[model samples]
Target: MDSVDLQVLAAARRWAAEGRRFAWVTVARTWGSAPRPPGSWLALRDDGRVEGSVSGGCVEDDLIARMRGNRLGGGQPFILAYGVTQEEAVRYGLPCGGTLELVVEPSPDPAQLEDLAARLGQHQLTQRQVDIASGTVTIAAAERGDALSWDGGRLITVHGPRWRLLIIGAGQVSRYLAHMALALDYEIIVCDPRKEYGPGWDVPGTRLVTTLPDDTLFALEPDARLAVVALTHDPKLDDMVLMEALKLPAFYIGAIGSRLNNAKRRDRLARYFDLSEQELARLRGPVGLAIGSRTPPEIALAILAEMTAVKNGVAVPLRDAVAEP
Candidate 1:
């Protein structure tokens, strides 16, 4: 789930606490070109207020229209299948035969929802199993590798912090990266031990850690879901962290520098640290797409955009992979 889904989950709990009825919508399944993936959420209040989306925009509009007329979900949970036919697809503007199978849970147990929200915020992997036949909802701990599983009778969705990013420099680029990462539901930690760079680091929803980057890497115990980005542009600082991060399980280990600098850095790592080609292969330098970014914010955007592609298992071509150096 992204930040928007988290917002809806929190709002649903709040509405239930207020004794106000609302429909919690879930995109249970999707056909081709679905804008939102399965398990994406939207909270719809009794007064027709919405907090998320299952379609690009059309489906929500239709739901809102039904909600205003008092003709939507109420007494029991229900299923809504949008864009079933070609005519319906054309009318709803579902691109490339896109369709959405949604589940609306009205008046769910507030206590359970709140507990789930708290646990998810704490970065715990949680699985929600909902039995449509009995209206029984159960929450349990899930493994890191769990994916959304839905049968006709029951739906199980996994929720937790999907990615952890360790930005090894609390510089200007780091700030923009942290800000962008939050929207994608990544737990970001900005690390910089230098007094000049680490002190008074302020970015909402991101943690500031004043620890040496290499030590921070060890503390993180990085797994495949973690990404380490070094942006200090200082060899002493970035090199130390990359040395440790390269040996770890992080899926992305990148540093901000140029192609020539990267080549020199790689040779140094190979000669001094005895890093193998396989290990060096894991390092992404000239990180981000080749978008000709210059400003700090644009550079940060390019970095995260590349990270996003990598996270989604998208293979970026080498020609388009090196944004800078």
Candidate 2:
């Protein structure tokens, strides 16, 4: 789930609390090209109010009209498809013969939605299963790997953070990064055994561990969905963790520092730590994009921007190109 979907959830809950009738729309499938991915959410209120999006503009317009006219859904849930034909695609402004299949629930249970929100708040991966004909819904615990599944009759969507970010050091950059990463569907864990930093570390939605960086990394047993960022700027702490992190299958392992410092760090890892060239290659030193970030917040933004690009499989410039050689 991204920030857009989270905002949609919040808006839907607010409307529900006001006792307003609303329908929930979810993008079930898409073909060719889509403005949004499958599993995106949209909430349509009774009085033509809308939150979230399923398409760029045209689809939302039609849904708004239908919602205002009380024709979006009957008693039970139904499937709606748009841009099936070339003319329909053109009419809906879908790019390259794009098509979107959506599931519309006329009367979603507020209690169930609340339960889902609560589970997500607790950092638990949850699965929501909806029956198309009966409008029955079930919520259960889901695995990190579980994804949205849509059969012809049933739709199951997974919610909560599927990714985890472990930040070493509770310094200024870690504070900004941890706060921002929450909205990107990341379960943040900040590790720092330094007592001086522990008292000031108070970012919500993040767990702070008072353990050595290397010890914390050893306990984490990092997988592909995990991203480890070293921000202590202390080679004693950062390098110890990197020695273990470089050999793992983590999706991203980065350390923040100057280009000269990172080059020196790389050399130390290779010479003393016995890290292979292949293992050393995995390190993203001088982490984050070259956005000319000078402050802590800007640095945080650049780091997440780079992380998102890498996570999405978008090719980014090599570190050498972005940093002074």
Candidate 3:
């Protein structure tokens, strides 16, 4: 689940606990170039209050109108389809004839919502299954590779922290990276053993560790859902982590520095660490794309962009885009 989805759950829990009449909407499926993906949630109160999005801004107007008029839900779960025809698509503001299928449930169980939110807050992956015939929601353990599974009868949505980012420095760039990654629903952890960097380090929704980068990297043993970025320019801190991280199954492994410095770092790793050619190829130096970024935030954006592409299995060319030191 995304942070936005978590927020929606929290809001829904609060509203239900307050005895407010509300409807829970989820993007059960989409066809063509949909604006929002499946499992995106929206909570709408009887008074037109909303908490999340289903199609960005395309299909909300009609939804709110119908829900406010008590057209969507009463005591039974139901489905709503938008943009069934080309003219309907245009009229409803769906882009490029996109279609949205939604699941609307009225007066959901507040205790269930609270349990789901708490599990996600603790970073546990959970699957939420809604049985349309019975209007029941079941919680189950979710596997790492599980996606939103919807048949005509049941809607199964996976929620929790699905991605982890391990940053090997507590510097300014790492700060920006951690901040930006949080919005993208990544669990961020920064590891720096230096006492100087540890004293005043603080970032909301992120964890900072004082262990050395090498030890930290080994302990994580980063899996396919993890991305490792080395922001410290020092070879001693960055190289040890790289030497270990490159051999792992992590989706992304990158080091931050000038191209010249990265090249030297690569050569040194090859000469000293006995990393194979294939292993060396797995490392992304001068991390991120060709964005002409100069500031820390801009650079962080570029790094995350590349990481996202790699995570989604998109082959975007780098073209040697690292910013010059």
Candidate 4:
């Protein structure tokens, strides 16, 4: 599944292929409270078609009007500010007197769009830098820490997955989780040393590693942007991952099992593996929310839901498997 930015880039490329005129808008900066964050993308076709969004309904409407009237960027790139004043904020439907500075490209280069899309399709984190004065764009490799930078004359936006998810098993649940996480713009890496499991793994957009779980964890060099999930349900495999993962700085770490199974796993880690209480506290086991999920897909959904909540800094109670009747 393509992210909203990738979808917007695809739409722009499609319009270019069909010989259509379109304007591309990026939320370069925001003040107070804005609907979208910096680097949000929106494409406006000449016929009022829209892909993605920069603000609530009102901002898109204004962009559509400007596009239809041939007044968006006046044949070049320009910065358009909305909701600067309290009254203007209400008029534009911006919340809390928020303001948005958007960079509009009257005629974005089709070649540039295609290049960026190709790089992202190859699972490369790329940056597209646009010179606001000339509409000239340059594409380059980007690091995970790179962020969107707007200096009033240049706008640089990072594209592709900034977050990473490492799954220790390539089973059905992991397949579903990896597939779903791709839509959220996460670079997925699935590790399974068991030869039997490697042959059946067919999920695209995820890299499968045959190395030991601990080796995979070591190679990844877990950071705040990384998340590790164990789904093998094998103590030897899952515990191997947690032994090293819980010691790292990954933002989220989880393992799939029932409540009793996770409890045992935690005890084993503490007693044998020497995982600290604080480190073990970071492990989210019986992973996912209490969504009463029975099937593999539902379980995957719950996992992603919980992961999203944690990533957003939302306080979610620990999820435990309910006792069976």
Query: Pick by lDDT: which candidate is best?
Result: 2
- Number of colliding residue pairs in model 1: 2
Q: What are the per-residue Cα lDDT tens digits for candidate 1 across 1-325? A: 5878888988898888888888778889998888899999998887889998888788998888888788776556678899999877877878888888987787677888988988887778899988888888899998878899887778899987668999988888888889988888888988898899777698988888887889888987778889999999888889999988888889888889887778888998999999999999888887777788888888889889889888889987533234443
* Candidate numbers sorted by TM-score from highest down: 3, 1, 2, 4
RMSD of each: 2.4, 3.5, 2.2, 3.8
251 Cα displacement, candidate 3 (Å): 1.7
- C-alpha displacement of 28 in model 1, angstroms? 0.9
As a TM-score, model 4 comes out at 0.78
TM-score of each: 0.90, 0.81, 0.91, 0.78
lDDT of 3 by residue, 1-325 (tens): 5778777888888888788888888899999878778999999988888898987575888878987787876777888899999998888888889999998887677777888877877777899998899988888778878888899889999887558999988988898889999989898889998888977779998888988887887787567888999998989899989999988898899999888888898899999999999999988997888788889888898899999999889997643646563
- At residue 140, candidate 2 shows an lDDT of 98
TM-score of 3: 0.91
Q: Which stretches of candidate 4 lie over 4 Å from their true place?
A: 73-75, 133-136, 170-183, 187-224, 247-249, 258-260, 270-281, 290-298, 315-325
Query: Per-residue error at 137 for model 1, in Å?
Result: 1.4
Per-residue alpha-carbon lDDT of candidate 2 for residues 1-325, written as tens digits (9 for 90 to 100): 5778888889999999999899999999999999999889999999878899988899999998999877975669999999999998998888999999999999898998899889988767799998987789999999767888998799999887557899999999999999889988788989999888988999988999998988898787787778999998889989999999999988888998888889999999999999999999888888998888888999889889988988888987646633431
Winner on lDDT (2 vs 3) = 2
Residue pairs clashing, model 4: none
Error of 4 at 185 (Å): 4.0
lDDT of 4 by residue, 34-114 (tens): 988999999999999999998888989988888788786556788999998999899899999999999888888899888
Model 2 reaches what TM-score against the true structure?
A: 0.81
